[model samples]
Target: MKRERDHQFECGICGAEDRYLLHNVRHRTPSYRRLCTNCLLKDHRGLFCPFCFSVYEEPLPIDRSMCNKCPSISHKPCIPSNYPHHTPFICPSCSSPNFSFFNPTTNGDSPSGRIIDRDSARALVAAAKIAAVSMTKAAAMAKVEAEKRVKEATYAKKRAREALERLAYLAAKEKEIMEGKGGGSNYNGLYLAPPPPPPPQITGKVEK
Candidate 1:
């Protein structure tokens, strides 16, 4: 145990890094995470014997043991016989059939329960907000892309219609020239007349 105390570790509650003794405050996990002096004295003051329902005093290290599932503490006499005597121990409250993971306490209002509940709730809310923001941005981008594709399609259709109209106009003019319907030669869709037979020869100016 003394060798374990030499290592620098972070407190389970406040996240302060320092050399401290180990305690199992974190829920669900069987392993014991480290706890600082401030957390043991300040936050975990309610740690008491679940069987006797009495708080342990100073010099409690000899008789007291922490639960592997939660921050619960127990005395030698309060400890159950079936429970194995080892580094990891489970208190009676945790071993009960009505045990709950989120609410680790009997009354659901314990100090550790409140911390876990509040943190879990805040995390869920933050995740929801981020997801909503991402979805909104994606929808907006999709709408813009859809509009751009529609505009491109409309422009392409208009260009195709204009090309068809130009082809129809040239075809009509070519047919007219080929059949001699214009009564003269047509140069590049332009019609020319025969020049009116040279204006009656215009001999010696006009007559009288």
Candidate 2:
């Protein structure tokens, strides 16, 4: 029969020898030093539910809720059902009315069945309306600015084209003057009348 040897490893945090270290290898490793199961749970004391005072082992879907007024945490299901739904849930320790329950279900009291104050609902609607109007105005202003820029660009292009055409016409006129054909005339401006035909060179010496 073969006997299995037990290999022991030391915990980095508690310095205790153990066969395995308590850690979640699948996700992120905790920043705290490696420790055994007991030490690890002790280090993360905040993970325990305030209502049940128990720590979760696996990544179970725990209904965690936080008090808005204070830093206390609790399990949502543990809160009493008779707690006021219209007002914010208050922390028992702080007594400040700012904590809110997560994922509140609708009860058959109103038409929408959602518990909401009339004043709060009106404020939300007013804020939404103001935001919509402001956005519409901003869009209109942006469109006007864009159209103005486009018109300015188009005018600048047209002016550039006209200047080029004028330059071309002046260049053509200058070339014509250099070639001695001013005012579109075919005769060269530099040509003389052939020096009066040289007096008809005498046939033999002249008539005696």
Candidate 3:
């Protein structure tokens, strides 16, 4: 949608381009701050109300009319009794010049007065489906990549733990070798300590 009124702004939360909202709309939030639809729905608030930004909560009736000038929709209690049901309807903001923020479609892609051809509508639907499929594929790829990274990290940690255990075993063996000095500590297929002194050196010659 295009803004006609003077001021320009963005959503307080998401920083997406936005406009000054109605008092009722602003009050939907606890802080009465303005936000876009996606930002509001993160809290699971409401549906897509263009004027209120639906932040989504503000309940809107299913019975509604699409505006003639823009893609905005207005439902009961929100719109006037004189709202055209049969003919094209211009949304309140588009109809009124004095509104705090007035936005109507600048591009004539779907002007209410013009009915879209069947082929054009079909093409638009096809494009939307393609986009949705592409998004799903991208999300799947991201999830797979994240899982792979986690697996790799776990493997590295396991290898590190094994190495630490080996070092600890070697450290213990070194102490044992120093104390025993014989027939005790072996490491990596090698006897680390010298043989015991030849049975106290039998200095007095062998017995007859």
Candidate 4:
């Protein structure tokens, strides 16, 4: 079924005409009836309250808007003037006040205008604690795995070092043999002397 078109009031200030552009248009109250979008967002207090066109000349004592859902307090008004007030006072997802301090579901990406409450607040905190502990455990396990890998590498290095030392000792023995030192017998295969040249061939005719 087609939805009915809502009656929209013009911003008495800028005269911008359009339901979507109008600030707080969804919540049609007396004071906001003819106000422009700019003026409405600038309202620091209940200036644009539906009951009263509360444009208090002086800043109202209550500077912040309390979340109807979680009731968490935020520096930025739950209802920003530039954005649409889709879920005004209460959080749509958590159903808590938008002013909640600890919100698991209420990350930076959470949609605007949702409410949160005290019960939900506690739940959010508990969930966060569990997540933190889980992350810590995973990190510890990774460190242990890394240490094991390091130990294996060290063992391999030690074996290589021993093999190199044996090679050096064998080379020293071969050197001693070449220099006519007695150690030649110890390195049988490694220290073979060149064959003596054949006796000068008796090719020349034997002298009579």
Q: Pick the candidate with the highest lDDT.
A: 1
Ranking by lDDT: 1, 3, 2, 4
Which ten residues in a row are the worst by lDDT in model 3? 22-31
lDDT of 2 by residue, 13-81 (tens): 556654543332111321223344433433333444434444444574357666565454567887667
Instruction: Evaluate all candidate structures by whole-model CA lDDT and list the values in order.
Output: 0.55, 0.48, 0.49, 0.45
lDDT of 1 by residue, 81-158 (tens): 776566677765556656322221244567533343553333333333333443565666668979999999999999
Using TM-score as the yardstick, the better of models 2 and 3 is: 3
- Cα misplacement distance, residue 127 of candidate 2 (Å): 0.7
lDDT per residue as tens, model 3, 1-208: 3452322466556466644331112332222444443333322212233343322223646676666766556554556456544466666545655532222334456645344344334333333333344356566666897999999999999999999999999889787866666465566756656665676544667778
**Number of the predicted model whose TM-score against the real structure is largest:** 4
| Model 4 alpha-carbon drift over 4 Å, by segment | 1-112, 181-192, 200-208
Which of candidates 1 and 3 is the stronger one according to lDDT? 1
Model 4 clash number = 32
Each model's total of backbone clashes:
0, 0, 3, 32
Residue 123 lDDT, candidate 3, scale 0-100: 31
**Reference-based TM-score, model 1:** 0.33
- Superposing all C-alpha atoms, what RMSD in Å does each candidate have to the true structure? 20.9, 21.9, 15.7, 20.8
How much is the lDDT of residue 88 in candidate 3?
69
